[model samples]
Every structure is written in C-alpha cells, then in structure tokens.
Target: MRLNKTQYVALHLLMIFTFPSYPPYLIVAYYKPELVACSIPSAFQGQAQIKWSKAMITVNVLTIIPYALTALIIRSRKTSSFSRRLFRSLLLVMIFDVGSWLAAVSFIKLL
Candidate 1:
C-alpha cells in the first residue's frame, strides 16, 4: 500500500509523539507517584516496584529509538511509496508504540 503526502506526514508526526507523549508518564509515575496523586499498588511496593519501574523505563526507551527512526525516514521521503523496508519499520514502530502506550496508560491508571 502507498501513502500520500498527507498520510505520511501525519503518521510521522504521530510516531514522533509516541515517545515524548507517553514515556514521561511512566517515568513520573515511577519516581513520584504521589505527585501524580496515584500510588503504585501495595503489592508492587519495595523491590518489586523498583524492578518493574526499571524494566518499564528500559522497554520504553528501547522502543523510542525505532519510532524516532521511522518518523525520520517518513519525514525525509518525498515519494508516494516509501521503501518496503521503511514501511515494515514503520509498521513495527506503530505496533510497539501503540502497545506500549496502551500498557503504560493502563498501568498509570493503577497508580
């Protein structure tokens, strides 16, 4: 499938926001849950909490790079059909980012 200029731009922007928009919530929720007026579940307190927070940060940061790359590739392209490799990369970015966003939001709600 080919994306027109508008779709390319919009998707790129959305991917770019994927990291900036959501990960900070996870980070904040990790460090100062009280500031967000939400507490981690009692079950997750102590060492478990710390471990979970570290893992969350690691995964979120890892996903950010690819999404940023996908966004950059999309932004630089001037054609109707981007390379198949880029399309695959973008698809993976969307899948991972969307999944991570959903999970983060749900976890934050628990906070």
Candidate 2:
C-alpha cells in the first residue's frame, strides 16, 4: 500500500521510537528498583542478567544510527513513496545491525 507524506512521517516516528524505547525503561528499573520504582522481575537473573544487560547496552548504543538515518530521511528533499522509504530505512538498519554483529563477534574472537 502507498502512503502519503503524513503517513511516511508517522512511519518514521514510530520506527524511531519502537524498539529503541525499551532499553531506557529496563535500564531505569534494573538500576533503581524501589517500591515506587519499576521492577524487572526475577526472570533476568544470574548469567541471564549479564547477557541481557550486555545486549541491552549494545542495543541502546547502536540505535542512534538508525535514529539519525530516519531523521535525515524525514528531512531530506528527495521524496519517495512510503513503501520504498520504509524498505530502504529497514534495509539500512538491518545491514548495519548484521555488520556490527559480525564485527563485534570477530573482535571478541581475536581477544
């Protein structure tokens, strides 16, 4: 389905905030678990906690790239249909994610 400019912008807004929004809350709750604070429950315990923490930290740090790219796409003079824009944005993020993942693994293996 084709979307107009408004829908295209909305798509960008949603994409920027979707998965990237989760880490902030998890970070807050994990760090500041009080009666008034949010709790992350016992599911994230022991080694699981460590792995999850690392993944969360990595995700939060890496999310900035896509956010910047989306903002650029939104503000760019070049106009494209919603599906094409969405596909390009998603493809860019996916390529970045995979490349970074491989790089991290390779770096870790060397160490």
Candidate 3:
C-alpha cells in the first residue's frame, strides 16, 4: 500500500513514542556514562550504571537486526495489499522488539 502524505504523518507520529533507537545516546552512554544519566532514566549516578547501560543498549542494538531485515523486505518489495498486511505485521513486530528490549533493560536494572 502506497502511503499518502497524511498516512505517513500519522504513522510517523504513532512510531515516535516507541522508545527511539538513538545510536548517539548509546555512544555517550558507553564512552561517557556520567553524561547519560540525565538523559537516560535507568542510568543513574554510579559505576554500575555505566555497565548496565552499555549492556542494555547492546541488547537493543542486537534486536535491530530483526527489525531492519523486516523493514528491508517491506521496502524492497512493491507496495500492494500484501505489503499492507506485511506492514501491519511489521508494526506488531516493532512493538514487540522495542517492548522486549525495554523489558530486558528494566530487568537488568534490577540486577
């Protein structure tokens, strides 16, 4: 399905809340842990926070493999009713991807 301008806008806004995968933040968290505590809620002030933050981001980075592959398949294929169905399924996958990683992050915070 070809997305019209409005549909694209709506999809974008909807995706915005899905805990964005920002590489720069992960970089700062890895190289300069103190700096990220203010920006990253789970990253508090401590040496352990640095390790946990890096591990959480690492898991998040790994999860992107699946998300990217699904996205590439969707984009490489022609838009059609089938693609729309795939897009819908992709949204579900996206939700699960982000949710699972965040859950893992939360779990790590407890450790």
Candidate 1 C-alpha lDDT tens digits along 63-111? 6687678667676875356565667776786678767665865776575
lDDT of 2 by residue, 1-111 (tens): 999999999998997788666555554545634343133333343454455557755765676677667657766845568755785777677768867765764554355
Task: List the pairs of residues colliding in candidate 2.
Answer: none
The window of 10 residues in a row where model 3 has the poorest summed lDDT is 32-41
Worst 10 residues of 2 by lDDT: 34-43
Best by TM-score: 1
Per-residue CA lDDT of model 3 for 1-111, tens digit only, reads 899999999987876654354434454554543444234544444554565567657766776787777777777886687876877787787778778767866876576
Better of 2 and 3 by TM-score: 3
What would the TM-score be for candidate 1 when compared with the true structure?
Answer: 0.36
lDDT of each: 0.62, 0.62, 0.64
Which candidate model has the greater TM-score, 1 or 3?
Answer: 1
TM-score of 3: 0.35
Q: Superpose all Cα atoms of candidate 3 onto the true structure and report the RMSD in Å to 1 decimal.
A: 11.0
State how far residue 106 of model 3 sits from its true place (Å). Answer: 12
In terms of TM-score, how similar is model 2 to the real structure?
Answer: 0.32
